[model samples]
Target chain A: MRNIFIIFKRELKSYFNNPLAYVLIIIFSLLSMGLTFVIGDFLKMNDASLTSFFFFHPWIYMIFGPAIGMRLWSEEHRMGTTELLLTMPISAWQAIVGKFLAACVVLAAALLSTISIVFTVYYLGKPDGQMIVSGYIGSFLVGASSIAITCAISAFTRNQISCLLVAVAVCFVLVLAGFPRVTEFLRPNFPALADIGNSVSFWWHQSEMARGIIRLQSPVYLLSLIGFSLYLTGVIIRGKRS
Target chain B: MIDIANLTKHFGPKVAVDNLSLSVQKGQVLGFLGPNGAGKSTAMRMITGYLPPTSGSIVIGGIDMLEDPNAAKALIGYLPESAPLYQDMTVEGFLSFAAELRGLDGQRRRDAVGNALATCFLEGVRRQSIDTLSKGYRHRTCLAQAIIHDPEVLILDEPTDGLDPNQKDVVRNLIRHMGKTKAIIFSTHILEEVEACCTRAVIIDRGKVVADGTPDHLKRHAARAGSVTVRFQNAPGGLRQDLEKLKYGARLEAVETAGSTLSAVVYPKTKADASNLSAEIYELARSRNLALSELHEEPGRLDEMFRELTSQNKV
Candidate 1:
C-alpha cells in the first residue's frame, strides 16, 4: 500500500506538471457546456434541473477520459521507464492501481471544475440537490470506466494515438450497446442479444442515476468493469516484464 | 553475493545467452566484457530479475530469484543500458522517488537521496528537470537513482558508455570506490575499463564465457608471452637456424623472419625454469659477427589475446 501511494503521488504530480492536463480540462469544459446549451435546448426549457447537462456526460467522458488516460502506460513503455518501474520492489498490481488512481484524480478534477453549470441552474431556479449529487456520482463512475479501459489498451501498445483510437472505438461500442435505438432494433429479431447489451451498457445505468434513482446494481456494475479492466492491465504489464 | 548457473535465454528459436555460469563475491568488481550482441545485457537483466531465464537458477545473497524475486531484487541496484529516466522530473525529485521505491522512509530517505546526489555530482543541478539537463548530467542523474538505496549488489550495464573522457574517469573512480563493499558487475566493450577498474573479468563471446581471470593472468595468455624480436642490420644467412639450435633451443616455440628482423617466442618447457635466451641469442650473434640493431623481450598484449580468443569460429 505504501508503494502504491508513492507511485500514485509521482504519477499525479506528473499530470499537473505537463500542459496537456490544463488543455484537457478546457476541452472537456467546452464540450460539456456546449452540448447542453446548443443541442439540448437548455434555454428553451428554462428548467432548473441539469438533466440536459448530465445527459451529454457519457459521450463527453468517452472523449476526455481516453485523452487523459492514453499517456498512463504508453508514455512509460515508449520511454522505457517500464523496465525501471517493474524492476523496483513494488508489485505489478501496485503500479497499475496507482496509475489508475492517478488518472481518476485528474478525471475527478476535470469533472468537478464544471460546477459553474450547477451554479447557473441553481441561481435560475430551485434544482433538486439529490438528483445533482447522484448525477455527479454517476458521471464519476462512467469516467472511471472509460479511463480504466484506456489504461488497459495503452499497455498493449506504446503509441498514444493507437491507444486513443482503440479506446474510443471500444468505449463507443459500449455506449452504442445501450442506446434505445440499437436495443430496440435487436429486440425485434433477437430479444436475448438485446438483453445482454442492455445489461452491459454504461448508459443503461448512468441514465438511471441521472434520474436520481441510486440502485445498488449500478455502482456494482461500474466497479466490476473498472476492476476487470485494471486486472487485464496488470496482466499486460507482467507479461512485458518477462 | 550473486550466483548464476547454466543461465540461458532464448528468443523463440534463437538463443541470446547460452549455457553460462559465474559468481561474484562481496568486495569484487567483475567486468563483463564482450562485443555487441554477445548477451552481456541479457545476462545482467536475468541477474537483476528483470528477465526470467529459459533454463537456469540465480541466487542472490542466498535468495532464489526464480522462487522469490522480490527479496532478491530488493538487494540489487541496476542501471540498464541507455539509462532510461523520467525526463519531466527534477533530479532531487527523481532521486527521492527512487529512494521511496527502494523502501527508505522519513529521514533515511532524505539522507539517501542527498548522499546519491552528492556522490554523483548532481548537487548543482538537483533542482533542474532531467530533460533540461545535458547528457552528462542526465547520465549522472540515472546513476544517482540506481545507488539511492545503496544496495549490496550492483549490476550496471555499460555505466560509462557515451560519456566524455573526464566524465568517464569520474564514473570509473566512483565504481572503484564503491567496489570496496558491494558485489558489483558492470558490462562494457571497452577493454581499458577492465584493467582500470575491474578486479576480475569474464570475456564472453556469442553467449558463452570464453575466458575468466584477473587482468594480469589473461594478459599473460597472449601468444607473444616472453617473446623477443631481434632486428639485424647486417644479416647472417643461417641466423634463424642458428638461433633455433642454441642451448635453450627447446624453449623456442617458433622463429619467423620479417625483412631484416628475426623474432622468436619462447614457451617455457618446464614450469619452474623459463630460460632467458636473449643473452644466448646475443652471444651467438656476436660469435657469428652479425650486427644487432634491436633485441628486446615483449610482454603479452591483451588486445591481441582478446581478439585471438573470441574470434574462434563455431563448427
Candidate 2:
C-alpha cells in the first residue's frame, strides 16, 4: 500500500511537471465552454438542467481521455524504465492502481476546470443545482471510465500514437452506441441491443445525471468497467515483465 | 547468499539461459564474464526477479524468489544496462521517491538518501533536474537509487558501462567499499574490471560455464607451456638445431631469420622445465657470438583466456 502511494505520488507529480497537463486543461476548458454557449445562445435550448454541459461529454472524452492516458505505460516501456519498476518490490496490481489513480487525479483536475460552465448557466437562469452537480459527477465518472479503459489499452503497445488512436476508436464506439437514430437502425435486426440501447450507453447514463437523477446503477456500470479494465492492465503489465 | 540451480529461460525457440547453476556467498564479488548475447543479462534479470525462469529455483538470502518475490526482490539492488530514470525529476526528488518506494521515511530516510547521494558523488546535482544533468550524473543517480535501501545483494549489469575513466574510478571504489558487506554480482566484458574489482569470476559462453576461478588461478592456467622467441644480433648458424636437440621442446615449429635476426617457437614438452630450457638456449647462442636480442618468458594474458573461452563456445 505504501509502495502504491509512493508510485502514485510520483506519477501525479510527473503530470504537473509536464506542460501537456496545463495545455490540455486550457484547451479543454475553452472547447467545453466555447461549444456550450455557442449552441446555447444560438439554438436557445433554454432549460433548467445542464443539457449543454453534459451533452458534450461523449465527444470531449473521445480526444481528452486518450491524450491523458496514452503515455501511461507506452512511454515507460519506450524509455526502458519498465524493467526497473518491475524489478522492485511492488506487485503488478500495485503498479496498475498507482497509475490509474494518478490518471484519475488529472481527470478530476480537468473536470474541475469546467466548473465555470456551471456558473455561466446558473447566472443566466435559475438552473437546478442538483442537476448541475449530478451532471458534473456523471461527467467525471464517464471520464474516469474512458481514461481507465484507455490506460489499459496503452499497456498493449509501446507507441503512444497507437495507444491514442486505439483509445479514440474504442471510445467512439461506446459513444455511437447511445444515439437514437443508431438504436432505430438496430431495432429491426437486433431488438435486444436496441432495447439495451442508448440506455446502456454512456450518453444515456450521463443524461440521467445531468437531469439530477443520481441512480445507483449508473455508477455501478462505470465503476465495474473501470475495475475490469484496470485488472486487465495488471495482467498485461505482468506479461511484459517476463 | 544467492543460490541459482538449473536456471533456464526460453523465448519461443531460442533458449536464452540453459541450465545455469551458480551461487554467490556473502561478501563475495562474482564477475559474470561473457560475450554479447551469451545470456549474462538474461541470467541477471532472472536472479533479480525481473524475468521468471522456465525451470529453476532461485533463493536469495533464504527467501524463495518465486514464492515471496517481493521479499527476495527487496533484498537486491539491480542496475540494468541503461539507468532508467524520471528525467523530469531532480536528483533529490528522484532519490526521495526511491526511498519512499523502499518504505523509508523520516530522518533515517533522509540520512540514507544523503549517504547514497554523497557516496555516488551526486550532491552537486541534487537540485538539478535529471534532464539537464550529464550522462555521468544520470548514471550516478541510477546507482544511488539502487543502493538506497542497502540490500544484501547487488546485481549490476555493466554498472560502469557509460562512465568516463575518472567516473569509473569513483564508481569502482564505491562498489569495492560496498562489497565488504554485500554480495556483488557484476557482469562485464572488461577484463581489467575483473582484476580490479572481482574476487572470483565465472566465464559463461553459449549459455554455459567455461571457466570459473580467481584471476590468479586463470593467469597460472594460461602461464603453463608458455613460449619465448629469441633474436640474435649476429648469426648463430647451428644455434636453432642445437637448442631443438637440447630436449626442452617436443618440436620446433619454425626458425626464421631476416638481417641476422632469428625467431622460433619451441613447443615445450609437458614435463619440460623452464630453467633448463632457458639455460640450454642461452648456452647454444653464447658459444656462437649471438647477442641474444630477446629471450624472455611471456606474461599470462587473462584477456586472451576470456577471448579464447568465448570464441570456443562460439565455434
Candidate 3:
C-alpha cells in the first residue's frame, strides 16, 4: 500500500510538473461548458438541470482520457525507466494501480472543474440534488473507464502518439456501440446484437446513471471494465519483463 | 552475496542468455567483460531480477529471487545500461522516490537521498531537473538512486560507458572504494577497467562463461605470456641458431636484426617461468661475448587473452 502511494505521488506530481495537465484541464473545462451551452442547447432547453452538461461528458472524455493516460506507461518504456521501476521491490500490480489512480485523479479534477454549471442550475431554480450528484458520478465513471482502456493500450506500445490514437479509436467504438442511431440501425436487422452492444456500451451505462436511475449494474459494469483493463495492463507489463 | 546458477533466457527461439552461472561474495568486485552481443546486459538484468530467467535460480543474501522477489530485490541496487531516470524530476526528488520505493521514509528517506547525492557528487545539482542535466550528471543521478538504500548487492550494467576519461577514472575509483563491503558486478568491454577495479573478472561470449579468473590469472592465458625479449647492440653470428640449439625449455619465436642492433623474442615451450627462460638466454649471451642492452619478460596482455577467449572460432 505504501509502495502504491509512493508511485502514485510521483506519477501525479509528474503530470503537474509539466504544462500538459494544466493545459488539459483548461481545455476540458472550456470544451465541456461550451458544448453544454452551445451545441447542447442548455439555455434553450429552459430546464433546471445539468442534462446538457452531462450529455457532453462521454464525448469530451473520449479525448481527455487518452490524452491524460497515454503517457503513463508509454513514456516509461520510451525513457527506459521500466527497467528501473520494475526492478524495485514493489509488485507490477502496485505500479499499475498507482498510475491508474493518478490518471483517475486528474480526470476527477477535470470533472470537478465543471461544478460551476451545477451552481448555475441551483441559482436558476431548484434542481434534483441527488440526480446532479449521480450525473457527476456517471461522468467520472465514463472518464475512468476511458482512462483504464488507455492505460492498457499505453502498456502495449512505447509510442505515446500511437497510444493516444489507438485509445481514441477504441473509445470511439465503445461510445458508438450503443449510440442511438447505430443501435436503431442494428435493431431492425439484428435486435439481439443491439442488446449485446448496449449491454457493453459506455454510453448506455453512463446515460442510465445520468437519468438518476443509479442501477446496480451501471457502476458495476464500469467498475468491472476498469478492473479488467487494469488486469490486462498488468499482464502486458509482466510479459515484457520476461 | 549473489549466487546465480545455470541462468538462461530465451527471446522466442533465440537464446539471449544461455546456461550461465556465476557468484559474487561480499567485498568482491566482479568485472563482467564481453564483446558486443555477448549477453552481458542480459545476464545483469536477470541477476537484478529485472528480467526473469528461463531456468535458473538467483539467491541474493540467501533469499530466492523466484520464490520471493520483493525481499530479494530489496537487497539489490541496479543501474541499467542506459542509466534511465524520470527526466522531469529534480535530482533530489528522484533520489527520494527511489529511497521511498526501497521502503525508506521521513527522516531516513531524506538522509538517504542526501547521502546518495553526496556520494555520487551530485550535491551541486540536487534541485536541477534531470533532463536539464548533462549526460554525466544524469548517469550519476541514476547511480545515486541505486545506492540510496545502500543495498548489499550492486549490479551495474556498463556504469562507466559514454563517460570521458576523467569521469571514468572517478567512477572506477568509486567502485573500488565501495567494493570493500558490497558485492559488486559491473559490465564493461574496456579491459583496463577490469584491471583497475575488479578483484575477479568473468568473460562471457555467446551467452556462456568463456573465461573467469583474477586479472593476472586471465592475462597469463595470453599467447605471449611467459615469453622473454632480448635486445643486443652487437649481433653475434648464428645467434638464432645458437639460441634455438640452447634448449632452455624455450623457442625463439622471432629475431630482428637492425643495423648492428639485434632484438629477439623467445617463447617458452611449456608454461614455464619467463624469468627462468630469460636467465638461460642471459647465460648464452654472456658466453658469446655479446653486448646486451635490455632483457625482460613480458607480463602478457589482457586484450590478447580477451580476444583468444571470446573469439568465434574458439569452442
Task: Show model 2 residue runs off by greater than 4 Å.
Answer: A40-43, A196-200, B220-225, B228-242, B245-267, B271-299, B313-315
Local error of candidate 1 at residue B15 (angstroms):
1.5
Q: What DockQ do you compute for every candidate structure?
A: 0.74, 0.69, 0.89
Model 1 docking grade: medium
Order the candidate numbers by TM-score, best to worst: 3, 1, 2
Q: How displaced is residue A204 in candidate 3, in Å? A: 0.9
lDDT values, one for every candidate: 0.87, 0.84, 0.91
Q: Which candidate is the best by lDDT?
A: 3
Q: Please write out the lDDT profile of model 3 over residues A49-159, one tens digit for every residue.
A: 887788878888889999999999999999999999999999999999999999999998888888899899999988999889899898899999999999999998999
- Report clash pairs, candidate 1: none
Evaluate residue B115 in candidate 2 and report its C-alpha lDDT on the 0 to 100 scale.
92
Q: For each candidate, how many residue pairs have backbone atoms clashing (under 3 Å)?
A: 0, 0, 0
- Give lDDT: candidate 2, residue B308: 68
- C-alpha lDDT of residue B140 in model 1: 85
Candidate 2: tens digits of C-alpha lDDT, residues A63-181: 88899999889988887888888888988788888988998889888888988777767777888888788888888888888898898999999999999999999988887787777
Of 2 and 3, the candidate ranking higher by TM-score: 3
Pick by DockQ: which candidate is best? 3
Candidate 3 residue spans exceeding 4 A from truth: B286-290
- Model 1 TM-score is 0.92
